[model samples]
Target: MSAVQTQPGGGETRYRIAVDTGGTFTDVVVGSSTGDMAVGKALTTYDRVFTGFEGAVRRAAQSVGWDGDEVLRNADVIVYGTTHATNAVLTGRVAKTALLVTDGFADTLLLREGGRRDAFDSKAAYPPPYIPRQLTFEITERLSAEGEVLTPLDEEQVRSVLRTFPDHGIEAIAVACLWSIINDVHESRIAELIEEVLPGVPYTLSNDANPTIREYRRASAASIDASLKPLMADHLGKLRGDLLQFGFDGDLLVVTSEGAVLDVVDVLDRPVLLLNSGPSMAPLVGAAAAPERETVVVCDMGGTTYDVSLVEKGVVRHTREAWLGEPFVGHLTGLSSVAVTSIGAGGGSIAWIDAGGLLRVGPQSARSTPGPAAYGLGGEEPTVTDACVVLGYLDAQGFEGGFTLDHDAAVKAIETRIAKPLGMDVLVAAQAILDVSGHQMATATRQAALEHGVDPRGALIVAGGGAGAMVAAIIGNILEADTVLIPATAGVLAAYGAHRAPIATEFLSPLHNDTRNFDSASAASAVKELGKKAKFFAARFETVNPDAQFSYFVDARYPGQAWDLRVYLDGAPDATGDAARQIEDAFHAEHDRRNGTHDPASRVEIITWGVRVEIPRHELLSDEVTVTGESVVHRHDPIVFGGESHVTPRYRGVTLSPGQHIAGPAIIDQPTTTIVIPPEWDADLDDRSNIYLNRKEA
Candidate 1:
């Protein structure tokens, strides 16, 4: 049941809601068109998704002193962000799909681009392909690199093979013909045949799914897209029906891996785009909160993992190499997505003693069902949260949902599971657990920074998530960063991020051109055609965001390079020799910036041209901060930090004023999360109501 508060409203209030369902919590943020926002969080209900979703929504409405029933009836738009597709792909719970490839390419998925995570570790286990060999069918077709059909497609053979799909229990089909990007006739014909032979079965075509130059990535994208069609179609359909049943009559948009929102109808056609849906929203918030022309490392510490991403000049970084699990050992999504590095070091990460009497923190999470031992939810294992309680960093009465933590249970779990095993004090063992996890979290943040060509020491730190503020200062200290920005809505930052993401989509077409032998007429034609498509794409969002904008980019590389780099063009290139030279120069600059080296004098090979169309969100107001200067202390709690116990002054979040200063050895207990100010760090609230943590004087 939703935690509803029966308050009378005018019954005409408009609402915009964003719901992000994570592994541990389902966060809901309700925003009015005027830019007022409120957040609510509840433990994720794996059994009934709507239970947690409605509960969070109700609580958020209550926080704003409004009626939830009225809010639901009048919601204008509801954006939903989910990790369902990501989890399904990683856990091998996707639909049973069949892959149909060109003749003599049955081992394409098996070989997996011929790369390993650790080239020196030959003993590592080899991962199986997405579709089994038995389910892979080879069609008699051939297309050369120049769009010429070397061998005509055997329609009879394709029809004969497709007729047997039912026997193999194939729920969906993926057709990836070799050189389909150069010539799509054969793949298009197969799509027609699939419709004729297996009427109701869903299918994906490489030419339609991803028209890239890479053979493996195109096929991988088609296969993954096809695998998700059946599962997501049913899931989304059910969700829409359930929403209608719950009295919601609004536009339903789902978050995409590309850090934008797509209408549910559009997502139903390309569900694979939802692979990194939930975490992608975090960078949107981080970028918006950060200052322009500056670099910031965004760290979102959730219940199960700590996620890190880099933002430069207010642009969230995007990558094409998103893996399902274990980096190179796992399958690739073969799509451009917001880049994030995640480590298993969150509040729910279990702490235990290894066989050698060494203390180790997770990698392993207790999840939301059992949660932490301190939650009093029948969890017996010691977790990072239990350790936090043992260290007095968390208050027993300050948790979400008006629930109190089990202090005795936290102490018992740590002592019985860790302290007794190592013959050490319970508090000491708890501190060790935190130290290990903090080191891992700090290392990941630094690695993400270095990978994105930003120095950790130079970039500002923006920490979020329910567990993020609890350890933000600790991470900042380890990196020795000057300051950390903790947004007042840090706990539900991703949900807030979903509001900032606009309706956007990308379109790409392939062309082979060289700087010396440039095809200006063909390049102009491709851009013109893509521009039309982008215009049509923008038309769909006219009702919500009419003033859409477009950007153009090119994929080019040094001659004979294995991979190409993307460079956004300031304007569309003309049919002149100078334009070709300019494109070459831009490619060189981008290559150097991303890869740290570029051969400016080398010949350039241009592969793909693309256009991005977006309807940017409306800007109305800044953060709705109403300062009272009435900072109230919850209590003076004795918290352990830096090998010493100190009675820290705990302040309430809502009662704090702008520019209010709180020194070290204090706690700022917000409604959703608690921030532990270590003895060496001092926190001050800015005019935007953001807490800026800086190091104390020497």
Candidate 2:
């Protein structure tokens, strides 16, 4: 159930709610017609996600002086984002699935494109496939690369192989045949047979799930979706039931990695779309929080991982291929999505001395149950939060949800686990941890900006997540960014982004044509087909948003190139030479911008054509903070900064009004998070209650 509270007015109130279930926390945002938003946060309960979901909603309701039940009863729209799919794949908690491939390519998933980051390092261990070799079953089907049926599918052999599903105890099945994307006749037939043999078991076909060119990537997407079918179906079913029982009867939508929201019914079939959905929302929040900035880097530092994404010219960057665990080493999903990079650096990331005698912070986290040593929840390992406590960056009594930090436990954990091994005092070890963690985050931020063709010098960095603001200014300063924008809801900013994110769906069609000899008729036909699909998807949202906006993009590259850069199309493709020329010109411009060279004389090849439809969410104007109050320091605490202990001024966020200025060697404590402004930096609150931090020298 939701939090219990009573409000005075019982009039008709329209509500908008968004919930983000993360690895460490479940965040909620309740928005009203009055442009007011209340945020709630609770530790994630892995056993039953709805327990934490309801608790978070209740927390938000309590903050707004409204009964949680009332808010749910009146909500018009509810958007949800989660890290469950990603976690399932990473932790191997997915259903036991079988991979059915064409006869000769049973090792397709094993080969994995034969690409590696360290090409010469033969000693590096090769990673295993998502599905093991023992579980792969081959189908006697043959189709040429040009989609010609070379041999008919063997019906008797298919029945024999599928009949073993019960003995193998397969919960789901994935069908990926050769040349399926070009013509899915054989794959479709196999799917029909699967349903006949296994009535209740779910199966996914490669062409239906991801219609990309590559075989391995397409198979990976299909396998992932098939694996998550049972898990996500159950998870979403319980969530839907809980919300309905709480009196909510509105439209329920789930956010996708592409940063778009889709209906529950539309996404339940292909749950892979929800992978990385939580991190994708950070960029949207950055764009909305910094409307005036042309570019912003959104960094989400949670308890388990730090996810970074770029927003350039107010548009979130899109990627054709996204890896779930690690790029070039992990499984790649060929579906188009918002590009995000994650590193194992967060508040609960453990700090320990490596065998090489170097201090390291995590790819492993304590998560929420044991949390940090500072939580006094039976965790013994020293984490970043413990280091912060030992260094006095985190207050013992200022934690969110009225939780208290165990200072003595934090110090002891740091001393025994890190300081003693490193041959340094606890304070010095904590400072070193902070410095090392800061460098890791800054390095990631720099790489994200560079890969996206954005310069960090003038780009704004929006600090989000619980540990985001604490180290945001430091990371931005290292990159020499223009400024750092920390929203008041920094801890729950992903939920805030989902609260205002648009309803969107993308449709993709493959094309392999050189621009010089482009088949305009064929291209026009393909674009028209994609448009039909887009329209059908948009119709599902008509009840909530009457008008939906549509956009188009084409992936193009110079002939013989391994990868292509996406260029926005002016509109739908046309059966004219001029339209092809326009697309070629756009390719040249993008190539020049990204590679510093343009090949106008070279033939441009278009690989994939895409159509995206988005129905914009209702814009909520932020309430102006007009409580004229001076910035007063609550107290002075000895905090380690720049390797030295200095008395730092601490102020509560609630007492700071718009236009109030504070110079660093200071800290601003919000209920959910803390902002540390280092020396030579100054901070000011804007009308929207966003903290803008700038270097005094700049």
lDDT of 2 by residue, 536-602 (tens): 8878768767898888988888888988788887887674647678888989998897789998888
Best by TM-score: 1
User: TM-score of each candidate?
Assistant: 0.96, 0.95
Per-residue lDDT tens digits of candidate 1, residues 1-698?
A: 34433325533447788898988888888877545677898888887677888888888878878777766766888899988888888888889999999999997787686646786877765578888889999999898899899999999999999999898888999999998887799998999999999999999998777789888788888899999999889878877887899788899999998999999989989888898777898888788777584898999998888889888899989888888777766777567888988888888999988888788999889888798899888899999889889899888887875368999999999999999988989888889888888889999999888877788898889999989998899899899898998987898888888977888888998988888888888788888889899999998788777899898888888888888888888876765547688888899899888888989888888899888888986753347697655789978988999668998898888899888899988888887888888999999988878898998878
Pairs of residues at least 3 apart in sequence or in different chains that clash in candidate 1:
none
> What's the true lDDT of residue 321 in model 2?
68
Q: Which stretches of candidate 2 lie over 4 Å from their true place?
A: 1-10, 120-126, 620-623, 626-632
Worst 10 residues of 2 by lDDT: 2-11
Q: What's the lDDT for all of these models? A: 0.85, 0.84
Q: lDDT for model 1, on a 0 to 1 scale?
A: 0.85
Model 1 misplacement above 4 A: 1-11, 118-125, 576-578, 620-622
